[model samples]
Target: MTGTRLVIDGVTLTAGAYRLVEDVSLAARPGEVIGLVGPNGSGKSSLLRAVYRVLRPVTGRVSVDGTDAWSLPVRQLARTVAAVVQESGAEFDLSVREVVAMGRTPHKRLLDGDTPEDAALITSALAAVDATDLAHRPFDQLSGGERQRVLIARALAQQPSLLVLDEPTNHLDIRHQLEVLGALRRLPATVMVALHDLNLAAYYCDRLYVLRDGKVTAAGPPADVLTPQLLDEVYGVMGEVTIHPRTGAPQVTFLPAEPHPAAPTGAEHSSS
Candidate 1:
């Protein structure tokens, strides 16, 4: 199989003295789109960093296609995994095409230039993300959404078997968000994405792992996991989960909390 199998076994992540994720175990089959959905500071980004080798876990392991990811050489790991993190700081001034072409570096020898195949891949990647028109622009000058599309194009150009993206839809418009996620769904790579939009996750992901306070609160298909009680407990909100008639995916609608009673009038407070 061309797709990669991802197994995150009993993974725990920490930052210095602070623990970020605890005993989180998840798996993504070849070509599957798995989602990590959670509130802010729930350790979604931390776990993703472990998978992409940015942050090593204090305990447990991340494996890609049955090989321990931590044991792989840096270049080999890059060839096997591509990640699009939320932090998009451009250290150097480069054209969008130049940035996308960087994805070919892991496969090339020192001082090697782009082959025809590399060029084709770069072109296709831009098209896949709807960034073809911005290819000639300076990456630093693009808007947040534009830069996001370009970065995704760069990752697509890498053609890795496993793709890890931290909020790939961040800063994108509604149409582009759907388009970008739809493109990801068509790829052959095994994808793991962190998303705050539960409805989008429900529609796109094959399975979901919900995190809360750095612990996994639920894991299963969206329909099985996204109930009103789960939403209330995990998110502290009143929500309704229904199966979409056309898509058959769980649809979530959050209800407003009841208004608090008006503060006591000044005269009443004075009387007290």
Candidate 2:
């Protein structure tokens, strides 16, 4: 929790005639895990893009530790914040070890040499994600989940203050999903993860940001923002919100929507 505090003030993003995200503001303190949740196309990804500098915001600012993130040099930003995005394709068939070593690029000079210390750090990162066994394996040959873990280890090798993950659980099994997220929670770095699974988010996140249609529908602790009414209104579904008796965090169970009447047959429609 040293220097990871981030503040987003009135951030807005646009694409041509469309406003993808508008007036999104939030603050994340050091060592906290914040989950960004919303339906598909709700601008969650767009907001992430803005934060990561892949897409510049149309207005407002993103600040980290009282300094404008945009003002930081690209290499400085890479050293401070590491990200694991949804789509990462490796065109070259590098070994897993080689891939993980690339995380050190931000710290290296144009012709700087990597010492034995750098190699040891890469090995440590591989061990952190349980990818040491696959270090020698070809990256292209590993399973989807294995690749995901290696990528995560690569990000960890950066030793960043802020770690951002967009859909890290995309290809993971339930057990691996929990394992990855649990490990992330145990890390000291401040984290912001975009998650689709409400149950997982409820289990791991210290705070939540619920986005709907390019704006924040609710922002607070899970118990305060994830009410049944809010879920129904934002997600178009009815669900029960209950507290985990042990943890006291909000847990949601979705209920089926009521059925609608069937459409009239073609013959009946013609007669009408």
lDDT of 2 by residue, 37-130 (tens): 9999998888888777887888999988889999999999998899899987665479999899999999899987778988998998898777
Clashes of 2: 0
Q: Best candidate per TM-score, number?
A: 1
Question: Residue by residue across 4-35, what tens digits does model 1's lDDT show?
Answer: 99999999888888999999899999999999
Q: Which runs in model 2 stand beyond 4 Å of their true positions?
A: 1-3, 258-272
Model 1 segments more than 4 A misplaced: 259-272
lDDT of 2: 0.88
Strongest candidate by lDDT:
1
